[model samples]
Target: MSKSYSHPYWLDVPALKGQAGQPPDGEICIIGSGLSGVSAAYWLLEKGFEDLILVDDQPEIAATFRNCGHILYGTVESMKALVALHGEEKAQKLWALSIDVCHEVRDTMQRLAIDAEYRQEGYLVMAIDAVEDREIKESIALLHKHGFDSAYVDQKELEKLGFRNVFGARFEPGSAQAHPTKFRNGLLQHCLKRGLKYYSGVSVKSVDEIQGKVRVQTERSEHWYEAAVIAANAYSPLLSRFFAEHHLVEPFRGQIICSEPLDEPIPVSIPHSFDHGYEYALRTADNRLMIGGWRNHTPHGEVGTYDIGVNPEVEQGLKDFVAKHYSFQKPLAWEHSWSGIMAASKTGFPFIGPTDSARIYTVAGYTGHGFSWAHGSAKILADVMNGDPIPPIVAEACNPRS
Candidate 1:
């Protein structure tokens, strides 16, 4: 079933429509009620900023709803690669930023008493080839030197854990996973309770500076706010030309499939991935298997497109991945399949500060690690908007103009 729009396997929960149904009439307008936007509103409210408005095209099913439920601790690249790309200090700060956000999410859910089905079961980064095997070992060594508790596993141990055709793996004990839509719903409800004015099905056409205020022009009408934050992720370019002109974010579509709950579970206990995150699979809480990210094998590489329609070739690649990696008790019956777009950052880190327009800001370009970045990045955005000082390292790494 190849449709133009995505149909994720997550539950279809109703959008959180706050006290008002009309567009925002507040001092601060958050354009895009995805995890990023909701997180921004939460942080802003925490910073004593009231009268905030959150709007979304379809808040009921934001793009994060379509992501795998993994709460990863870093970007798709290994820690070693990160250090090589941005010196040791910057890489260390970047890694700490990810860890902070991940823990904040867990703490927030716990404090709010929201059962998001979050589990700190950690993650396994398996190596599909010799090169990655070596990379994993090196990355683990670097992580340990930096006081992280990651460990490297040999192929024999991997076989014991039921993974096949892999040389070695890196196990990060601090990582975790969750129920995507469940977590989003809980967070949204928490924000609403904190005086966040949320409106659903309100898509913004453009965010422009008008009369010393930010003009959020929607399809139906225009609403003005003292300031605005563009947290739309992959869709940011569609709303503002600055992002496209600067080539800040690129949209890449990813496909995923879910299998019927198995009577006898596969030997794998936690979420795992390989090939620089081109393929990943995990057993859900309900005993079903969900896998995604075979876009690497797709004909067009799944880039520069918003359509999340499932590609048959990429779907077949995922099935083949399953057949090659594991030996199931019975033939798997895939019951659901879907896809979604991810925003890859050209600057290697998400833009999380003021843009060219003083009245407008941004926190987009998470580069497929939104769950790990949104909350913490939103904190930085809030600080910047509040005239507070942000860490110099963060200022340089996530600079919007950079």
Candidate 2:
């Protein structure tokens, strides 16, 4: 799939060579070349920020997204989970802003001509039991109360729609998914054309605010910039030792699997999730059934973003669920499995603004919705970096202090 999406293996893409006598110092340095960092770099370069340095631990760009199958905006249900903690007004605001983020991802891809196979096919969230069915009903009401579009699907209706004995479900109309590898790489190539310099395979040791500048020290070199954006997400806690005490971000691992391309593609590319988003699946552009998520089954053990191999139980559960759902008498014959660490926060939203040191900014802890929120969060953070006043909606939804 090289050159199929984002420089296939990052070949021909640019990288910063600190070992080759390149200066570590820059006016602006962005840490981590994942989706969040790349997205921020794209928006920042568009706003006239140049000579920027992008660094990552991986050997290539969009490595994380490469494993992801879909990017549907599906966090409204999570907002409902947080309503008890954040209150109704705040929940509605968060819900609305999240929906906007979905639009943001689509609009940005279109504007940048990022060919990530962007498709607006919507998503299907199902509930298999009484408790989850109740949750779906409440979620629909909440979304409708806020004037968003969502429709409920009952057991009989779901059966007719190609499921057996489904309890209930909801459809999020404006949702969409993309070929993640292509999206991130496409964005990276576009940003490179606009003068974004990225360095890969550089392990960042620490980040600190010294005297007046933010210093980022990697295993091979150290650099100081006017300011820095810690876009590492889950990896932030490990890299930015100074901010770990604030306990701002916690890393969580998300594992995924791929099944053989279906002889016939599903009628539509509607992504699926249920059990409070503890499970999810989607068909890839190549018509493969890719699905994962069930960390709740191994809740305590699944924490920490380190490179822990896939849990056998969790992986097996994913295969079994897919088999049962699609009515495969035997297993679906798993094609591939993999995992990566992602950031989670006390709040479901990202910590998208300034850190304790106003000069040191960050955008992490997107939970598992990084794809849904990363671009818009990056744009908001970029707007702030350029000294533009933070818009009320952004401030309301992404205030780090909150």
Off by over 4 Å in 1: 1-6, 12-21, 400-402
Best by TM-score: 1
Residues 276-353 of candidate 2 have per-residue lDDT tens digits of 777787777778777778777885848865764666787788776765666443345456676667767766678777
> What local distance difference test score does each model get?
0.81, 0.72
Model 2 poorest 10 in a row by lDDT:
1-10
| Worst lDDT 10-window in candidate 1 | 11-20
In model 2, the Cα lDDT at residue 37 comes to 88
Can you give the lDDT of residue 195 in candidate 1?
74
Tell me the deviation in Å of residue 148 in model 2: 0.5
Return the lDDT, model 1, position 343.
Answer: 90
Tell me the tens digit of each residue's lDDT in model 1 across 1-402: 334224676844544554445675779999887788988998898889999888888654456878888888887779989989888788887888888889988988888887877888889898999998888888888887887789888899888877679888888888888887777778888777777877777878998887798888888888888999999999999898678788889999888888877998676768889787788778888888889988877677898998767788888888889888877767788877888888988766788887778889899888777886887788888998999776787777776463
